[model samples]
Target chain A: MNILVCVKQVPDTNEIKIDPDTNTLIRDGVPSIVNPFDGYALEAAARIKDNAPDTKIVVLSMGPQQAETALCECLAIAADKAYLVTDRAFGGSDTLATSYILSKAIEKVEELENEKFDAVFCGKQAIDGDTAQVGPELAEHLGYPQVTCALEVKSEADGLHVYREAEDGKEVIGVKTPCLITFTKPSFDPRFPTIKRKIAARKAKIAQLTAAELTSIDPAHAGLKGSPTKVKRTYVPPRKEAGVVVKEETVEASAHKLFDLLSKAHVI
Target chain B: MPNYLKVTPEIIAELEKAAPGRVVTGADVNPDYSKDEMPIYGVRMPDVSIDAQSTEEVSAIMKICYEHDIPVTTRGAGTGLVGGCTPICGGVVICTMRMNRILSYDLENFAVTVQPGVLLQQLAEDALKHGCMYPPDPGEKMATLGGNVATNAGGMRAVKYGCTRDYVRAMTVVLPNGEITRFGGTVSKTSSGYSLVNLMIGSEGTLGIITELTLKLIPAPQATVSLMAPFEDLAACISVVPKFFMKHYQPQALEFFEKEILVSSEQYLGKQVFPRKIEGTDIGAYLLITFDGNSMEELDPIVESASEMLLEEGALDVLVADTPPKLKDIWAARSSFLEGIEEQTKLLDECDVVVPVNKIAPYVEFVDEAKKNYDFEVKYFGHAGDGNLHIYECSTDMDREEFKKQVREFLDSIYRKTMEFGGQISGEHGIGLGKVHYLEEAAGSVNMGLMLGIKKVFDPKLILNPGKVCMKL
Candidate 1:
C-alpha cells in the first residue's frame, strides 16, 4: 500500500505569547513545530508502515522553504520520501485554493513516484488555522470517499478500516482504496526521530515543486488573488472574570467547601 | 541532650507581634506546615506557625525563639523528600515562603540576590529571562532556594555545573542566638576566613536560618539536544555511563531510568516520549542524555559521536528530542517519576545514595540482589552522570509500619553496601528526620561527634531545627 500524508509547520501555540496591550500574538520567540494533528496523521501512516513494511509512506507539504524542517522531521519518522510545494504564487492561499493546489501536487507526486497512493492522510485541522476544511476539500478535488476524525487505520484486503472518534464513542468505518482520511489526536504520540534517521534526513535532498513546474495548474487558481475568503480582523478574546478559588490548605476541606457551594446552588 | 522550651500562648503572642497576622496556633495551623513531602517519616505540628515576611521579621522571630529556647524549624516550600522541613519538635515553624523576593541582579559580578524563600523554579525562569541559567535543576522545582542551600542540593546538572553550594556567593543568616550576620561575598574567589558560608550550606537548617542569598549564575547555553539510548537490560545501559567521563564528553545531564518507571511516568504525564520496546526486545533501561553548546553546529558532531558510541555499547537505538515540544515532552516524563510512583504506590520509601561512577553497575546489582529478600517492590533510577541512584521500596500489601520495619532492615544492608562503594547516605536529599539514623550509622562515631561539635558552635541552645542532621536532641 502506498500512503501519502499532508504535513504542515505551525507555531507551537503553547509557547505563543500574547501582547497584553496590543492583543496580538508575539510569534517572534515562538518555535515552529509539526502541526500536532498532522503529526498524528503521519504517525497513523507510520503505524500502517510498521506492520506492512512494504507500504511506502510519502509525505508532502505546501509551505515556505523553511517548512522543509517539518518535511525533514516527517522523513526522519519513517517516511520514504518528502516533497515540498513551494512558490511565491502559493503564498496567502486559503484552504480552498490550498486544497486545489495540493490535489494537483498529489497527482504530480503520484506520477513522479510511478505509484498511485492507495490512501491519503491529513490532520483534521491545522492548529494555527482551525478551519478543518483542507482535507475534505482536497478529497472533493480528488473525488475520493473521505473520513474525518480517524483515530486509527489499518489496511485490509478489500479496503481500509478506519476507527474514527465520535461524540459518544468510536465509530469504525471502512472505505475502499484511494480514499482520503483526516486524523484526530490518538492515544499514542508520534514516535521520536531516531538519531540515525535524523542524520540520514539531514543529508537527503528534499524534492521541491515550484509554481512554474506545476504546468497543469493555472496561476488564476493560486495564491490570495484566486481565494474568495478574506480575513478582516483578529483579536484576542476578552479575559474571563476570575472565579472563586476556595483555599482551605487541605483537599478534603476544599472538597467540602465546594460541596457546600454546590448544595447552595442546587447543582448537586 | 538539651531540654528545649515549648511554645505557650505568650510565645505565640510574641511571634505574632513580630510577624503580625502571620502566626497561627494549634489546630488553626495547616497540617502541611508540620511536615515535608515524605509523610511516612515522623510528623509533629508546630505549636505556632509564623510566616516571616522579611529579614527583620525572621531575625525578630529568631530572637523570640532563642530567648525562650524554643525549637525553631525554618521551612521553605516543604517539598523536601527527607522531611527536612518537618517540625519534629513542636515549637515555632518559621516559614520563609512569605519572604519570597528576587532582590536584584549583579550582571557584572555574575550573581543574583534573592530572598531565601524564592523558589528554585521561579529563579530558573527569571534567570533565563536575564540570559543566564541557574544550573542546579533539582527534581523538586518548587523547593525553596534556602532549603536547597541548606541541603546543598545537587541535581542532574551537578556533573557539569556543581551543586547549590557552588552557586552560593553571599547570604544573610540569623544564627540560633539571634545574631544577624552576613557571610561570604559576591567575589569569584574567597579565601578570606573560616568559610562560614560553606558550613551553613548542607547544614540542613540546624545551625541558622537563611533569609537572603546571593547566587552565582552562568550565561545560558544557546543550544541543547537531548538523546535517549534504550538498552535491553539495565546492566548494559548503566555500564556505558562511565564511558562518557572516560571519553571527556561533558553532558549537561545524564539520567537513567528503568522501563517500569518510564511507563509509570508516561501514564502520569499522558505522553510517551521514550520507546518501551525497540526492535524485537523490550527495553529494560534507558540512558537519557543531553548536550548543550554555543550552537547546533558545535553540538552536531558531539551528538553524532555520542549516539554512535551508545549504539556500539549495545543500545537498541538512540532517539533524539531537540525541538521545544519534544524536549518538554521528554523532560516531563523524566521529571514526573516521583509523582507517578507516589500516585500508584500504597507505600513508598526512597534512598538517594551517590556512589563512585565506575561502581554504579555493581552497586545497583547489589541493590537488585537485596530486593529479592524483601516482599516490597523495588524501583531504581538516577542521575547516572553522577552515580546518584534513587531507589524506592514500595508495597501495597504490607501495612505502613510493617513496610517501615522491613525497609529498616533493607536499608541497613544497602547503606552498608553504599559505604562499601565509598558513597554517601544522602546525595541531593538532605539527612532530614527520615535518614538521621542512617547518616549517624554511615558517618561513624568520631565523625558524628565532630558534626555534633560543629552544630554546638552554631546552635548552642539546640533551638534551630533540632533533631536533624547532626542534632540528636
Candidate 2:
C-alpha cells in the first residue's frame, strides 16, 4: 500500500508572542514545528507501515524551502520519501487555492514516483489558518470519499476502518481504497525518532515540485492572486478572568457557598 | 542526654509574642509537622509549632526557646527523604514554609536573594523568566530551598553545574543561642576566615536555622537536547559512562535505570515512552543523557558523535528528544520513579550512595547480589555520570518492624561495601536520624569527633534539631 500525508510547518503557538501595539504575531525568534494535527496524520500513516512493512509512506508539503525541515522530520519518523511543493507563485495561497495546487501536485508526484497512492491523509486543520476547508476540499478535488476527525485507523481486507470522533461519541466507519482521511489528536502521542533515522533524515534528498513542473495546475487558480477568501483583520482574543476559589472550613460549607454563588449568577 | 524543658503556657506566651498568631499547640498542630517524607525513621509531635515568617521572628523565637531551654526543630516544606526536617524532640518546631518569597535578583553579580522557604520549582521557573538559571535541579521540585541547602542536595545536573552547596553563596542564620549572623556573602571567593557557609550547608538543621539565602545563578542554555540509549543489560549500560568523560563529552545530566523501574514509572504515568523491545531484542536498561550549548549548531556535532559512540558501545539504539513534548515525556517518567515505587509498596527504605564513577557497575552488581539474600525487593537507579545511586528496598507483605530490622541489616552490608569502595553513605539525602549510625560507621571516630566538636561550637546545648547528622542528643 502507498500512503501520502500532507503536512504544514507553523510557528509553535505556545511560544508565539503577540505585539500589543499592532496585534501581529512576533515570529522572529519563535520556533517552527510540524502542525500537531498533521503530525498525527503522519503517525496514522506510520502505524499502517508498522503493521505492514511493505507499505510505502510518502510525505508532501506546500510551503517555503524552510518547510523541508518539517518534511525531513516526517521522514525520520516513518516516511519513505518526502517532497516539498514550493514556488514563488504558490505563496500566500488560501485554503481553496492550497487544495487546488495540492491536487495538481499530487498528480505530478504520482507520475514522478510512477505509483498512485491508495490513500491520502491530512490533518483536519492546520493550526495557523484553522479554516478546516483544505482536507474536505482536497477530497472533492480528487473525487474521493473522505473521513474527518479520525482518531484511529486500521487496515482491513478491502478497506480501512476509521474511528471518527464525533460530537456525540466515536463512530467507526469503513471506507474503500483510494480514500482520504483527516486525523485529529489521539489518546497517545507520536513516537520519538531514533538517532540513526535522525542522522539519515538530515542527509535525505527531498524532491521538490514547482509550479512549472505541475503543468496540470491552472495558473488562474493558484497563489495569493487566485485565492477567494480575504483575511481582513486578526487579533489575539482577550484573556478570560481567572475564576475565584470557593473555600470554607468544611466541604459541605464550601459546596453550599458554590451552590449559592451559582444560583445567584443564574448558572445552576 | 540533655533534659529539655517542656513548652509551658509561659513559653507559649513568649513564642506568641515573638511571632504573634503564627504559633499553634496540641491538636491544632498538623500531624505532617511531626514527620518528613520518611516516616519510617520515626515521628514526634512538637509541644509547640511556629510558622516563622522572617529572620527577626526566628531570632526572637530562638531567644525564648533558648531562655527556657526548650529543644527546637527547624523545618521547611518537609519533603526530606532522610527525615531531616522531622521534629524528633518534643519541644518547639519553627517552620519556614510561610516565609516563601523571592527577594531580589542582582544581574551584575548573577545572584538571586530568596527566602529559605521558597520552593526549588518556584526559583527554577522564575530565574528562566530573567534569562538566568538556578542549576541545582534535584528530583524533588517541591522541596523548599532551605531544605535543599540544609541537605546540600546533589541532583542530576550536578555532573555539570555542581550541587546546592555550590550555588549557596550567602545565608542569614539564627544561631542556637538566639544570635543572628550572616555567613559568607555575595562575593565569588572568600579567604578571610573559616567558611561558616560551607559548614552550615549539609548540616541537616543541626547547627542553626536558615532564614535567608543568596544563591548563584548562571545564564540559561540556549539550546538543549536529550538522548536515550538502550542497552542489553545494566552493566553494559553503565560501562559506557566513563567512556563519555574520557571522550570529553560533558552532558548536563546523565542518568541510568533498569527496565523494571522504567516499566513501573511508565505504568504509573499511563504512558509508554521507551520501547520495550527493539529489533527482536529486549531492552534491559537505558541511559538518559542531556546536552546543552549556546546553539543547535554547537550541539549538533556533539549529538551526532555521542549517538555514534553509544551505538558503538553496544547500545541497541539511541533515541533523540529535541522537542519540548518529547523531552517532557522522557523526563516525567524519570522523575516519577519514586512516586511509582511508593504507590505500589506498603513499606520503603532507600539510600543514596556515591562512589567512584568507575565503580557504579560493580556497586550495582553488588546490590543485585546482596538483595537476593534479603526478603524485600530492591529497585535502583542513579546519576550514572556522578555514581550516585538511589537504591530502594520495598515490600508489601512484611511486618513493619520486621521490614525495618531486615532493611537495617541490608543497609549495613551495603554501607560497609560502600566504605570499602571509598564512598559516602548519603549523596544528596543528608544523614538524619535514619542514617546517623551509618554516617558514624562510614566517617570514623576521628572525623566524627571533629564534626561533633563543630556542632558543639554552633549549638552548645545541642538544643537545635537534636538527633540529626553527627549529633545524637
Candidate 3:
C-alpha cells in the first residue's frame, strides 16, 4: 500500500520573539524547525514501510523556500521521496486553506507516482498554531474517515484499526482503506536519523511545486488572503509579580505559605 | 546507492499477518508522530507508528525492518536536545512511550529496573517513595530515562554524583540485526571485557536501541541547605571554587552565575533570592552552593565554616536560606540557567567545554576576550565545580547566516583553546548533529576511525541513529 505523510515547517517556539513596542510576533532571526508533532507522524509512516517493505512512504510539506530544510530532514529520516508545495500565493494560509492545498498536493503526488495513496498521515497539530483543525479538516475535504488522537494503528487488507485516546481512556476504531489519522503524543516514539541516512538525505533532491503547478486553484483560496483568522494583535503575557515570602524561620511556616499560595491558585 | 534489498508486497503481507493487531498503515498515521518538544522545526509525519507493548513486538518490528533494509529509529519521550528523536529520514519509528512499566525496584541492592520509556521525574519520585534518589536530574521533568541514558546526560548534581553513565548498571539493548543482549548487571563495579554498556551509554540510539535499564541508586540525604554568595568580582567568585575543593568541603552542588543570569533568574522565578539587588553594583557574579547530609547537625557546621571561608575569600556576603521550598527555588534558578540565557539572548548556541580545574579560569578569560575580539555577546556559567562551563554565544545584531558563521568561528576558537589546555569539546551534551566536527577535532582521525569501526561492529547495516557523533558513518 502506498502511504503519503503530510509535514509542515513552523517557527521555533523557543526562538520566537515578541516585539516589545508592538506586542506582535517577531519572526526575524527565528530558526525554522520541523513541527515537533510531525516527527511522530513521520515515525508512524516509516514504521509502515519497515513492516511492509514494498510500502513506499512519500512525504509532503508546505512552506516557503526555507521549508526545504524540513523536507530534507524527512528524507534524512528515511522517507523514500519528499515534495514541497511552495508558492507565494500559498503564504499565510490558515488551517482551512492549508488543508485544501495539502489535499490537492496529495492528489498530485498520487498522479506523479501513478498510484492512489492508501493512507495520509499527519501530526495532530502544529505547535505554533496548535489549532488542531488541519488534520480533521483535511480528512473532511478528502471524504476519508479520520481517527484523531490515534495512538496506535494496525493496518489490514480491508481497513485500518486504530487505538485512539479519549477523555475517559482509549477507544479502538476501524476505518476503511484511504483513511486519515492525527497522532497524539506518547502514541509512538519518533526515531533518530542515522549518519548514513543523513548524508543520503542531504544529497537527495526535494521536488518543489507551486500553486499553479499542483492544481488550478483560485488565488483567493491560498496564502494569507485565504486564511479566515486574522491576527489583530499578539502580545507577551505580563511578567508574573513576585510573591511575598512570609519571612518565617521554620520549615512549617514556609510550608503553610506554600499551601496558602497553592490554595489561592486553586491547585490544592 | 543500492536499493538492493527489495521489500516485496508478500513480505509486507507477512508482517501484517504476524502482527495482526499491531501494524498501522496509510492515512491512519497521525501527525503528532512527526516532531518533539522543539516545535520550530517542520514536521515529517511518519507513515505508521507501532506502540510496542513487549520486547517481542519490538524485536518483530526490528526483524521486519532488517529484512526490508528499512531505516528504523527508536524513540523514547522525545525530549532530545538535538533532533535525535526526529525521524529526519522518515523510516519506521518504534515508540517506547507505552512501555513505561517499572519492571523491578530492588531496595536491598540499591538498584531500579525500568522500561526505557519511564519518565525521569516519575522514576525520581518513585525512588523517593522508596527513600532513595536518582541523582541524574537533567532539569526536564518529562525526559525519559532512556533518553537520559542515550545522551549520558549530566545535570547540576553531576558535580557530585556524575552523569547518567555513572549510575547505569545494565541495559537491555536490541541490536541492529534484531538480537536482544544484556550487558552489565546490578553490581557496583565491573571489569568485564569490552564494556558494551558504557559504549551504549552515549551512543544516542545509533548502536542499538535500549529497551530496559538497571540503574544504580544512592541513599537520599536527609538534611539539605543552600547558600548564595555574592562576589564583588567574577574572577574572585570563580577563584574561590578551587579553594573549596582544596579544603575538602564536598558540596552537593556548586554553581556560578553572572549578575545578569542571577537577575534574570530572579525575574523568571519572580522571587528575591539574594538579600538585596547586587545588579549594577561592582559585584559581577554569584555562586549558589548547596550541601546535603544525613543529619542537620552534621551539615550545619560544614556549611557555617564554608560560609566563613567564602566571605574571607572576597565574598561580599554568604546568605543561608531555609530548606525545602526556598532551597528548591534556588536550584530551580540554577537548573533553568539555560532557559534564562535563551530568554535573554537572540540566538543561543551553547558549547559544553570541559577542561582541567585550573584551566577553567583561563578558558573563561579566553572566551571573554574572544567575545570582545569577535564583536559578539557570550555568557559563561555551568557546573563550575566540575569544570564543565557552558559558554553560550550569540549575535545581538548580526543576521542569521553571519550569526551562524560567527558562532561557528567563536566555537572553533574556544574549542582550539580548550584542546591546547587538554580538554574535551563536549562535557555532557552528546554529539547529535551540531558537534560532529568538534568531536572529530577533539578525538582526532585515529580515535574517530576506531569509533566508526565500533559503530560498524554494532550496527553492520548502519540502520541505527546514523550521522551523529562521528559523522558520515
Q: What share of the true interface contacts does each candidate keep?
A: 0.81, 0.70, 0.00
lDDT (10s digit) by residue, model 1, range B17-100: 898888889899989998987888878999988888888888888888889989899999998888888998888898889888
Roughly what TM-score does model 3 have, to 2 decimal places? 0.60
- Report iRMS (Å) of candidate 3: 21.0
- CAPRI-style class, candidate 2: medium
DockQ of each: 0.70, 0.64, 0.01
lDDT of 3: 0.77
Whole-model lDDT, candidate 2? 0.92
lDDT of 2 by residue, A26-72 (tens): 98978888999999998898888889999999999999999999998
In order, candidate lDDTs are 0.91, 0.92, 0.77
Candidate 2 lDDT over B1-473, as tens digits, reads: 78888889988998899989989999889898999878999999988899998999999999998888899999998988888778888899998999899999998899999999999999999999899999999999999999999999989899989999999999999999889999999999989899999999999999999999999999999999999999989989999999889988999999999999999988888888888888899999999999998998899899999999999999999999887767888899999999889888999999999999999999999999999988999999999989999999999999999999999999999998898998989989989989988988888799999999999999988899999988875
TM-score of 2: 0.94
**Candidate 3 chain B — worst ten consecutive residues by lDDT sum?**
B1-10
Which ranking of candidates, highest DockQ first?
1, 2, 3
Better of 1 and 3 by TM-score: 1
lDDT of 3 by residue, B1-473 (tens): 21324435665565676466766655675565666543333346655567667676777777887777766667787766555666555666678888898888899999999998899988998997788999987767787888899989887788788899999999898888888989888888878797989999998888988888999889998778777888886788888888878888888888887877667666666654453434345667888887878886787678777977897888876655432434655677776666666666675567888898777777788887888866567877878888888887755567766777787898899899999999888777667656778889889899999998998898777766556677453
Q: What local lDDT does model 1 show for residue B189? A: 90
TM-score for each predicted model, relative to the true structure: 0.95, 0.94, 0.60
